[model samples]
Structures are given as C-alpha cells and as structure tokens.
Target: MSAAARAHNPMPVLAGAVLVVMAAQQAIVPVLAPLARDLELPEWSLGLLMTSAAVMFTLTSSPWGRAVDRVGHRTVLLSGLSLGLVGMTGFAIVCQLAVSGVISGELGMALMIGTRSLLFGVAMGAVPTAAMAWVAANTSTTQERVKGLAQIGAVQGLAQALGPASGFVLAFAGFLGPVWAAPAVIAFALVAVAVLLPKGPSRRARAAAAAEAEQAEAAAPSKPLRPWDPRLWPVMLGGFGSFLTLGLVVVCVGFVVQDRLGYEGADAVRMTGLVSTVVGLVMVTMQAFVVPRLGWPPWRMLRSGIPLVALGAAGLMVADTLVLVTACMAVLAVGMGTVGPGYVSAPTLLVGPAEQGRVAGLVQTVTGSTFMIGPLGGSALYGINDWLPFAVGTGICVAGAIFVWTRKGPGETATAPAPQPELAPDPS
Candidate 1:
C-alpha cells in the first residue's frame, strides 16, 4: 500500500514488544547476587557476565539495524525474539543444573555467559533496532514520529522501573524463577509481534518500492545521507552524552547513598531502588505527557534539556542528604526525558525513510556503548574521589549543550521527506 493509504499505527505493538523484552532483560539484574551464590561463582564474575552482555549488545546493534532495512521489520523482530527465547531458556536450564549439582562451576559459568550474556545480547540489539525502525518507517509526519518514539521511551522507562521489583518478588519462588520467567515473557512478545505487527512488502514489491524511492531521491535536489554523515554527528553525540551521564549517575549513586548518606546493606539497596524508581517515573511522565504537549523540534528539545542535565549533575555534586539527592536526580531525569525522544527522532528527520533503520541502529549502538563505558568509568572516577563522576558528567552535559546549540536545525527538505510507503509486513 502507498504511504498515503497506510492508516494503521503499529507503534503500540512495537512499544509493547519493547516493554516485554526490556523487562525480561532487566528482571535478572536484582538477582545477580543470588545467582552468583546459586551457581557457586564469585560476585564479580556475575558482574563480568553483565559486562559481556553489554559488550555484545554494543557490537551487534548496527548489523541488526542494517538487517531490518533488508529483510523487513517483522521478520527481524520475530527472529530476535526467538533468539531471546532460546537464550533465556538455555540460561535458566544452566542455572537449574548448577544449583542441582548436575553441572560443574566453570562449565556452568561459561554456558551461562554464552547463552544469557552473549546470545541474549545479540537478541537485545535486534529487538530495539527493529522496533525503532518500525516506528520510523510507519510514521509519515514528524509529529507522529516524535510521539511514537516518545511512547517507546516511556514504555521502556516503565519497564525499567518495574523489572527489578518483579525480579525481587519472583525470587521468593526460587533463584531460577526469574531466570525462567524471562523466556516466558519473550514468548508472549513473540506471539504479540506475530499476531499484531503489520506485514511488510513482498520481495517484488520491496524491489519496486526501492526503485521508485531511488528515482525520487535522484530527482530531488538534496541527496540521501549516510548514518555517519557529518549532519548527524550532533544528534549522535547528544545521544551518547545523555546516556553517558545517565550511566555515571546509575553506578555512582549507590556509593553516594552508602558513603555520603550513611546508608548500607539493605538500607542502601532500598534507597538506591527508590531513587531509581523516582527517576524512571519522572522520565515516563515527561515523555508520555510533557513532550507530546510541547511538540518542540528535536534541536530545540536538546538545547533545553542539556543545560538542565548539567545543572542536575551539579546538584548531585553538592547534595548531602537523601532528600536533596532525590530532588537532584529528579532534575536529571527531567533532562533525560526531554533528551531521549529528541535524540532518537532528530536523526530520522535528517535522513530519508530508507535510512531510518541504520540511524536507529546507530542510536542504539551509542546507548550500548555508554552502558559499557559509563559504569566502569564512573566506578574508576569514584575510586579516585566520590565527587569525581558527577563533576565529569556535568562537564559532558555542558559540552553536549554547546555541541547541539551550534548545529543547524532540520532544513526544509529534511523536515519533510517524500512520503514513502510504510514498511509493513505481508498481510497474507
């Protein structure tokens, strides 16, 4: 069907898929210590497991994005979810075996990392890449695109807020409970995608679509842009800086709760969870309610958000009480809420529809890279001095503001690309 004729919005299904996948991925986080004990591995080894997953997630995103562009979003989404199901199930079985004394320690750790960390990481990269690409391809107007992306971000934030709590609650059943639950969640997502997501064009139709798109692009004065084109650097850097700041705060805040606020053990954990939940709520509120109402352009959102983030980081630096810290972190979450959708949507405005998958992949790659670097970097800086990570994050946010402020907003052609047909799945 033509772009003008495409009326159904797939954002809800895509967002639902993202929520389930992210929840499953995050559900294991709160149980890592228990998992370590159950598997008879050191606590730090579990940390390595998480690090390995981040590494794989970073490496696989771009390729998966490119695949979405080729094979279609529905195909890629289902494929990724299938992989996740397999990975989660495998990891759970490994955990069960280790706990039951059916597998040795070293072998079990290796198997767990292979299935849970590496394989699951690859699936993690694929799901979001396809989902974002689906959003970009399905939405015809900038307003629609921004709203769709914001919804995705909001759902993801909600999932992050609820995932750990679910994990902690499920632990009462057994350590393997959360582990097995991840696959079941992914299974449901797989069914939802298969049933609800619109089908893409057939091979011949896609070929024709590509040809027509290419002809239109050639006729237009402006050319198609690559993901790494200079015009997109501002958006890319803005995304990286925003998430890097977030990573720093996530890793360092617990230490601050313990050392600075005199909270420790379960008290420290509870305080940290409370702060994170508050942050997630703030982010969800902004993205879901505040951003759509404002409807500002992506560049404008970035300009407004970056300074707030810097100020929030500065607030964290001086905060001496839990109340003060929570207030500061709320400020930080507000900034992130503003920045997140803008970062995702801005690049889509710059590129044509054909490039959306690649750009979305690049955005996810930046996020994954920050996750890998931020915690380790923040921990190192914290080791040097308690205040160091927040200070450095402040600098990063300030630099991000300046970087975005200098870049030109979307040009006329970029603001309104030719209406290409939606990349829906085959209806048959």
Candidate 2:
C-alpha cells in the first residue's frame, strides 16, 4: 500500500496489536486466585507480584520512551513482545513446577515475580509507549490525534472485559492452560505487528526530519522538561488524580461488596466481576463512540471529566445497594474514559513531534506511579473507614477539576519545545 494510505489508517493494525498484548497481560487477573491456591501461596503474595510489576513498569517507561524515539516504534514494540513471550512462558513453567512439587512455594513465587511481574512489566511499558508514539507521529491534526489515542484506550477497555473471562474459561483446561495462553496471544500480536504495520519512515527520511528539527531548535533554544515542569504539571496532575481514583475503586470494590453489601466468597467474587465488566464496557462505549462524536478539545474533556469523577466518588461514598454502587461506578468509568485520551493528547499538542515519545513515556510513568500508590493508600484508608477513601478521592478529583478549569485549554499552546538534541535520528 501507499504511504498516504498507511498514514491515513494505521489504527486498525496498531489497535489489533495493542488489544492482543493488553488482553494477554490482563488475562492473569482471573487466574491469580487459582494459581495461588494450586501453588500453595498466600493470596496477598499475588498482590505483591502485581505491585512489583507496577514498579518495574513505572521505572522503565521513561527509558522505553527514549528507546522508541531512538530505535523506532516497530523495533521497540517487537522487542517488548518478545520479552513478554519469554516472560509468560517462564511463568507457566514455574506454575507447572509448583503443581508437580518440583519447586517449593517460596521459590515458585520468586520465579513468578522475576518472570511475570518484572519482565512483563517492562513489556507493558514498552508497548504502550510505542503505540502512542506511533499515533502521535502518524496523525497530523489535533482531532485525528485524539481519535487515534482514544481508539487505543477503547481497545484496552475491551481487553479488560474480555481477558478475564477468557482466562477463566481456559482454566478448565488445567493449571497450566491459562498461564501458557498468554505467550500464544503475544506471539500472535508480534506476527500481526510485523506483517501489518507499514515500514515507517526510512532511515534517510528520518535523518532529514531530525536535521530539520535540530535547525529549528537551534533557531529557538529551550530548556529540557522535568517531571515537575510547569507546562506538564497540569497534565501530570490530572492523570495522577484520575488513575489514583481508579486504583482506589478497583482495590476497594471487592471489599465493599463483601463487607458492606453482605456478600461473601464466590458471591462477592461474582459481583465484583460483574461490576468490573460493566465498567469496562461503559468505558469502551464512551471512548470509542462518544469521544469521537463529541469533537471537543482535550482541555474541554479534562474540564468536564474531573468534576464527573468527583461527583461519582461522592456518590459511591453514600451508596448502599449493589444497583446504586454500580450506577456510581459507571459514572466513574465515564469520567475516566473522557479524561484519559485528553490527558494523553493534550501534551502532544503543546510540543513538537520529536518529543512525543518522551511525553508519552512520562505520562505512562505517572499513571504507573498512581497504580502503585493508589491501591496501598486505598487499602489503608479503607481499613480505617470504608468512607474515608472515597471522601479523599472525591476531594482529589475536585482539586484536579479546579486546576484544569483555570488553565488554558488545547487552544492555548505552551512554549515547551520538543526534545531535540536528545533524540537520535531514527534509522529504519
């Protein structure tokens, strides 16, 4: 196909590849309990596994973003997928060892942390950074950028719904079945990416582009951006607040179902699953359908979403029945769906193309950090009082809303220059 055609429509291939990888990652959720039981590990050990992965993900993202800028998206993406495949295979082997009494429970858990958590976390960071960088590079207009990024998030939402169900069903095949399935899924994604993604800019073309960017930077020099840079503060703050809220809800919801709603064991698990599915579907619907049609700028979306999140958290604080809780959670989902794409796209608009990868990485890093902080913080507050977390989350969301409202929207561009000297020219 022609370059124009590829540029015009890379989403299908990118979205498909991302969906597969994300599904493979999320599939672990359903099998966590079963794996813990079979391996004779404590349930809380699973939480530690997840937390370790999040830490790796957070630490690696910025570097991976820099790699995407240096090596090109396809190379980084393929490498990440390969790492994920190896990681998943290793994790499956560890599980099989535990089941067969070939390894002690402590050793098995250690192997899981090394493979599934650490290795897979690095892959998670690489894939999303590459995907977002690809979108930012391919899409010319602001609206197109929003649509492309939103579609990525929509696919993730779909995967969040599909992965657990598929994993649960596959578990009937045996202890190793679901564990092994993740590598197979990633292998498919790797092949799809290799075949479908167009050979992006050639080495010479990238060199020329880089040289041009260098000249532009020389003409108007600017300082490097820090994590706490003023231009980036709003986007980072908004993302941290949004994901913190999400993390709190995700961790606490099951507890709330069991403790507050008088459900227990299998019933509580089923209810939590049902609620999660509904939230995922609502998020997918909003990002895929509602966002594209709204045609609102990123700033406007942020302004609108933050307040809704605050309101939803407040509702969840008072909700007693399952139906009421579901409604409140749905509200939170909508708010999250709206804010996510905007938080991603807005920073790209303010800078030049050269810095897209770095910005994408920084954004992912902030998000990862929140997931790490949110769950532990929420769990602690919930232990104190169920209402405390929600009340605090509501306050956080409201503060985010106020900050975003007072700032300039997407129409207002910041003076931050794209990363120029730091990014090596792409060489195929």
Q: Candidates' TM-scores?
A: 0.75, 0.77
Candidate 1's C-alpha runs over 4 A off are: 1-12, 32-51, 69-72, 92-112, 139-144, 168-180, 192-230, 254-271, 315-325, 348-361, 383-386, 401-428
Give the worst 10-residue stretch by lDDT in candidate 1.
419-428
Tens-place lDDT per residue, model 2, 1-428, is 22443544556876887787788876666455445555666535665777778888888877876676566777888888888888888988887888789999889999999999889888887887677766665555555565667777778889887775566466556645667889999988888888876675777776675566557557553555656866677777887898898876666676677667886534454565566667778888888889878977777888888888888889988889989988998899899889987887777766666555456667777888887777667766777788888998999999999888886764356434344233333323
Candidate-wise lDDT, in order: 0.75, 0.74
Residue 323 in candidate 2 has what lDDT?
A: 96
Pairs of residues clashing in candidate 2: none
Tell me the alpha-carbon RMSD of every candidate.
Answer: 4.8, 4.8
Which residue pairs clash within candidate 1? 198-425, 199-424, 199-425, 199-426, 200-424, 200-425, 200-426
Q: In candidate 2, how many Å is residue 226 off?
A: 3.4
